[model samples]
Target: MNEVFARGPSLLTRLCIVLMLSVGAMVIDTKVDNLSTLRTYLTSLVSPLQYIADLPGGLLDWSASRFNSRQKMLEENSRLTNQITLMNEKLQRFVVLEDENNNLRELLDAPVREGMYRMIAELMAVDNNPYSHQIVINKGAIHGVYEGQPVLDDTGVVGQIVEVGTTNSRVLLISDITHAIPVRISRNNIRMIASGSGSLNELSLNHVVHSGDIQEGDLLISSGLGNIFPAGYPVATIINIVRDESLPFASITAKPSAQLDRIKYLLLLWPPDIAPVDALSPSDELTREGS
Candidate 1:
């Protein structure tokens, strides 16, 4: 115990001796490569110990990198998701605009009468009742829309206005069960009444004799007998004609010329002498009415 407590050399003396030995070794290593073989052996012996000592620090570095990479990936995924959502919304808007542009172009290209005044109107709502095929327009009495006014699309006649309001009007489609239009066959000028079959694509010519000259694929035009629709406008095309000796009238079915189910924009027309003197052009009139 007494030898252990008694120091062999003073602190300053030991430190000075250690520094002298380190300097001597460094000088010998620089002068000659005498320590090379010794160093190689020492490194071989200490390599595993060095690796063991640095293991915790290497593990910590690897863990930090993995966590940071995961965080970056999550942020990138969220950013890409938001960008895709915005792109889809823009694409939908572009599609709607394209459809509206196409419909307007077709309406502009439709043939018009010499003395008739025309304006464009947009559909606001459709009647919910399944029994009635009616649609409401944005124009009404305030826009000079009146009851019994003729309505048409780019292709042909659509319907007539049944009720008028201050800013809206109800139109009875020609496909309604109660609707009928006077039609004349373009082939033989045989006049008949084309009644709605309660189907958007069908019209019936009731009370036709078996000896009628009507045939399939014949074009039917307005006969101008009702004074509501003008003459020469295409109404329907005969698609089926059944001649039966057992019935009084042959069963006749025709397809409407206008696309009633897909109507988006319509043409409201004022016949000759009915249009106002200051009536605006179709484009200007639609803009004014919409505003």
Candidate 2:
């Protein structure tokens, strides 16, 4: 134990030895090529250790780059999705506008008799009561629309206004069960009453004699007798004629000329005597009403 604890050299002696060894190593490294070869071998041996020491930094940088690339990709995907949704909404709006334009053009081209004033009206709401076939229009008394005013479409008569408000009015469709119009057969001028059959596509002709000259293909026009509807407008077409000798009148069914189920726009007309002097144009009235 004493030998293990004994000091081999004094502190000054050790310092002198270390200093002389360091000076000799420096002289050899500068003058002789032997130390250079040894240093090359030492560096070669330590190359793997140097790489191992830097591995964590290299791996961290690689992972950070991969994470950034993925984040950028996700952001791009989100932006593209939003853009696509916006484009689709715009496309749908264009389609609706195109349909509205076509409907307006057709309403403008409908036949109008001389001395009659006409204006366009759009449907606002439809009556959901199954018992009544009625619709609401954007025109009202404020716009010179009155109760009993005739309503029509591009093809023919639709109905008449029954109720009026300041900004809107109710129209009773010709297909309503309580509605009736005097019609004349275009072929032989025979007059008959075309009444609604409570169906959008059917009307009943009342009191038709079995021997009447009416046929299945005959066209019916307003006879201008009741003073409710104008003359020469198409009302309905005779589709079926059932003669029951057991009954007094023949059962006849006709299809209305107006597309009552699909109409979006309507025409309101005023006779020359009843035309309003202060009535605005259809376009101007619509803009004002909307605002």
Candidate 3:
């Protein structure tokens, strides 16, 4: 037994000492209400070598709380920003609609007789043809716009839709070499064909005899002779006229009533009914012959 004691401690003796200490601590704690409060003093006195016992648990709880708080704040900020952006966009659209309605009301109240209705179309692209005054619009069959439909602006006739697609249409302006309008001299009611001279600002009055009564600065209005355009819309104003006695006809030039240089937006005239123009286009002959 003395030899066993000399070698530090036998295994049984160590186990018995640990069991006794646990029993003592439990008994003292159950008998005293302040045993838990006194545990820190007892631990420091009994074991002065433990320094990092509670550090891992404290660090884990602190990091978890910080992570949750940061995540919640980021989500709240994103939701608020999206809401503000949507509200601002809606407000801007409302303002634009109000302004457009007011302008239409004023035009209706004007003294001019307006048989033409308007459909707003945005100018999508401009063609680079110097010899032809033409542009494209961002509207087509999907928007109820079609080929041969007359287009106009606030002042006068812009052109007609020459090509149409599902979502876009091409406009041939009045100054194109192939475009023409049936107009009459405002002075004497004489009718003539105003043909485009392939210039941006000038159109020529062809087939007017040397003795015609049209003078410089005379206004030309659509006569509704052709079913293509509605009548009484201002088409052009004669800028210059030269009738040489030796020539068979007058050499006349007129500026388009519709501005041809720049068009950001324009209006399309909607006919009461889009009756088939089978008589206008030869391709419709197939339908007629088949029937």
Candidate 4:
């Protein structure tokens, strides 16, 4: 131990020398600011190291705060959860309102039929029968919905109401096998019957001869023959035509213009002769009498 101490400066002497050197450096820095640039450079170089060294302490402090406050954390989580639920509900309502707005805009842009009054109705239920194309609407006799009343969308005729209850009505789609409409060729005004083929996308033009003027891509419009559907509304387009000498009638198929299976809202039309008369309540009658 004595030989090692003699080789280097004693521990007390080394400590005194370091203390004196530190005091001299601090006095020079305070008196003349000579070490300012050096101090700034050194701090800039050591800043990254200082941050790295403090990282563990900072992490420990963060963990203590984060895991220790169980009740407070639960309360904050619940508050955030409630806010999310409220936002979701608002988003749903916004979606519904946006759809309704679009439907109304389409209605406003549609051509108005002369002498026909229109009322909007919503679909309530769809018929599950794969063989039938029918839908039930929320409107009924109470809302002046009657049998044979025509149902139309923004594009064209959808169908006619076949059954009416007190608060609901059933509509037979134009694609139903039993349904038929008088449609005229929009190209030449040649009138014919368009019968449904029980297929959602197809209609049949019955009795069309081989020499008939109908051709593929010819548009069919309502001819207003049966007084059920109005004239000038688009109905279907001829998609296929097959003619054979053995068959008396040419086989013609048309695709409907209206999206019958995808429609969500419908318009119910009232003919001039079937205009609804509002039932007067007792108060309304008494007020009318007084007036």
Candidate 5:
């Protein structure tokens, strides 16, 4: 017992002394307010550890943003490329249309006989019949388009209006088998009749002799005798000529000067000699047919 109690003070006395020291330190900190600087120093010391803990998450967010930006740029680039390609195709078509417009303007500037007038119309539809080459134009009775009105392209005569509506009209191409036009030889003014052969590129001449002045490569133009088409318009070019002594007439074939299958725009002509009263009213005919 004596050895166990040999320490400087008993356990109870040592505990009381430690409590007193702790209370004295608390009082000094509260009354003097001297520990705030020490707390700031401690927080500064811990800041690097806090940053290290957050670094992984920050790096992950940055990487994801970078990837998304690259993907968006690629998509934008592809869209731009497609737009450029479409624009280029349209530009090519515009160039071709510009050239055609210039040629038609030249035709418009040419002097015509008194009281002759012209208007431009766009092709609205083409006939599906293989044997009949016909087209529809965007002009009708409302626009003064009447049956038998002459139609022309940039190069030459195209056809005549056969049926007219309020806003659209149908044309009977010169290449139709039932169609015929009076033409004359440009070299000698030798009059002949040109009939369509149900072929887009061929027209036949009627009652031509083997010894006639016409030959291959002769240019045929409208003679103005038919009272339909205007005079001096290019019609066709003679392509072939055959003669047989036993036959009364020579076989002659010519190609039309106008590109009927390729034209997109045409001119509707009004001739002075073709009195408006004499021309059939398309609206009246359509009404009769409908009835």
Candidate 6:
């Protein structure tokens, strides 16, 4: 190594000499205004080399942009497909509404209910209890659904409002064991008490007269006995009446007028003013207190 060093300068001394010369040139270019033209010429000469150095990065960025666009297009297509499916479902529901309106108009002229107000509400949920037949409606006291207000549907009377919430209400159906509504024969207006039997589609008549002028297939409508439900709204139909000479009252069973198993929407009676007549009527109060 000493013989090599003696022959000439070492490799490290040669690198340091080259570095010192490059730094001295940079300092001279920056300090001397007369060499500005030389610096500009050098910059222009190396511009194309700088462009060559940046080419690979630009190409990679363009490929990445194209890949992102393909992914965005796929996501946009999926969103459009879901929106179209939802619109089609809404269109089919409109058709059902049109048919139901036509039927209601026909019955309007058949000497049915008059001067009655109704609002459409969706059935939000049904209670999971065997003892109580309660349902949740999307309408509430905010929408004029007061406590004890009558609830019905196109087929028949379903229940009455028991609990009114801010935006929803709970209804106790006539099938509940605790619910009772005053009813009577539409043929002769013989008043009686209709009690829930805990069955989905049945109500039992309490203290029905042996000759109450009711027969199988007879439509038992809301006779406005308590005046809570509007008069002439179908409540049930006489299905069976078992007479027992040994017992005081006959065993009566009636099928509900409404489609209890398949009810999706309901009509909430929203009158201008609700009167709690059933709660205050002498006969109804007496029956309740007695029970």
Q: Which of 1 and 5 is the better model by lDDT?
A: 1
| Candidate order (lDDT) | 2, 1, 4, 5, 3, 6
Off by over 4 Å in 6: 1-114, 273-291
Pick the winner on lDDT between candidates 2 and 3.
Answer: 2
Local accuracy of candidate 1 as per-residue lDDT tens digits, 1-291:
988978689889999999999999999998888689899999999999999999999999999999999999997765554344333322422423443455558798766544456666778999989889999999887778888888877667788999999989999999999999998887677889999889999999988889988889998877778788766666788999888889888999999988899887777777757665444443342223322
| Candidate 6 weakest lDDT stretch, 10 residues | 282-291
lDDT of 4: 0.77
For candidate 3, lDDT tens digit of each residue in 108-146? 866642333344566888888776667989877777777
lDDT of 4 by residue, 22-104 (tens): 99988998998768988999999999999999999999999988887987988776555434433332242242344346555
Q: Model 4 segments beyond 4 Å from truth?
A: 1-113, 277-291
Total clashing pairs in model 2: 0
Instruction: Tell me the tens digit of each residue's lDDT in model 2 across 111-140.
Output: 654434566677899999999999999988
**Which pairs of residues have clashing backbones in candidate 1?**
none
Q: How many backbone clashes does candidate 5 have?
A: 0
lDDT of 5 by residue, 1-291 (tens): 878779588789999999999999788878876687887898999999999999999999999999999999997765554344333322422423443465558799776445345555778999998877789888888777889988877667788999999999999999999999999887677899999898887889999988999878887888788789866777899999989899999999999988876877676777645434433232222111110
C-alpha TM-scores of all predictions: 0.58, 0.57, 0.55, 0.56, 0.56, 0.55
| Best candidate, lDDT | 2
Candidate 6: tens digits of C-alpha lDDT, residues 1-291: 867658877789999999999999999978899898887898999999999999999999999999999999987765554334333322422433443466668787676433444455778999988777999989776666688888876667788998999889998888899988776665556667778898988889888767667788776667676767766666787899998878887889988877787766676664544522222121221112100
Better of 2 and 4 by TM-score: 2
Task: Tell me which residue pairs clash in candidate 5.
Answer: none
Q: Model 3 segments beyond 4 Å from truth?
A: 1-114, 275-291
**Which 10-residue window in model 3 sums to the lowest lDDT?**
282-291
